[model samples]
Target: MSEETTRGRAAVSGVAWRRRWRVPEKYRTKGTARPEGGGRSAGGDAPAPIRQWPLLLVLATTLVGLVVTLADFRIGLLIVGGALLTGAVLRAWLPAVGMLAVRSRFTDVVTYAVLGTAVVLLTLMAEPRPWLEVPFLSDILRFSVD
Candidate 1:
């Protein structure tokens, strides 16, 4: 094809691509979807860290749990679970939890609660002691394996 025709076709293709991938009005307005409950944990006048206290708290607790994990696996797991549970509680109770609000209030709460509970339960059921054994779980495992 001629150079002019090639350039014309390329321009048309680019236009078509742009139209195909055009962002919606809502997304174009903000360019990002802020989490449903994500608002400043503290006042607007507060510093960035203070405003994001909930997220910082959760991250700090998780970090502590990770550090503890290096020394005591079970205890560390419990701490991690506690941290997640704390996040759930904070998300549920607080109207504006800054970065801690990853989704809608209900969704974030449910996710945190479920994950925290699972972690704690699994930790309790760790081998050599099995603090929170469920008799049916063993039966189910055996049935599935068999």
Candidate 2:
């Protein structure tokens, strides 16, 4: 082919390449680069707003539970269970919790509640007093130990 024909073909191919790989309209331009302020750019979907208070409360409760663990192990387990229960409550009611809100709302709430209740019950039934006993748990522990 002639040099001019080759150059023309290259130009046509460049345009065709760009046309083939064209970005979707929604992601074409992010709002951050624009001088005029606006909400999020991707299809106008607003970012999840940060909720500080709930996050702080969860952190504080967890820290307190950790501190309690230094004194009495069984009571500390109860305190940790209480923290988990608090987290479950927050997950059920709060809209956004930054990092704490991991999984779907229903799953998170149920998981936290169940685990917390189990911890509380197990701690209560442990060792000396044995306020509430579960035959299955004792059997499982005995099997595991042997």
Candidate 3:
């Protein structure tokens, strides 16, 4: 091909490539919705650790609980539940919780609280001298089994 023709083809191909990779106008125009309390926990200029304190705290607590569970199941479970409960509390009260904010504030709080309560309750009701004894639960289990 002639020099001019080759250059023209190259330009056209470049344009085509750009068009193929470009974001759709509709999606580009639409604004993204940020999860509630999704901003940094600390100031914008804060260090990474400071900004993500909430997530770190929850994860650290969970890790500790898991490690403890290796030695003592009940206490470890309690600690895990407490960590989840703490996450719920922080999500509820903190204006910005960084990565801890996974959804709407209400949804996150409810999810965390429910999960924490369930864990703690189930742990307490574990076999062999259960701390929480629900008479109906035993009856229900028996009925279901029989």
* Index of the highest-lDDT prediction: 3
Measured against the true structure, the TM-scores of the candidates, in listed sequence, are: 0.79, 0.56, 0.79
Give lDDT: candidate 2, residue 74. Answer: 81
* CA RMSD per model (angstroms): 3.2, 10.6, 6.2
How large an RMSD does model 2 have? 10.6
List model 1 lDDT by residue over 18-74, tens digit each: 999998887666567888879788889989999999888999999999999999889
Model 2 has an lDDT value of: 0.74
Between 2 and 3, whose lDDT is larger? 3
Kindly list the per-residue Cα lDDT of model 3 for residues 53-97, writing each as its tens digit: 999999999999999999999999999999999999999999999
Q: CA lDDT of each candidate? A: 0.93, 0.74, 0.96
- Cα distance off (Å), candidate 2, residue 57: 1.3
Error of 3 at 49 (Å): 1.1
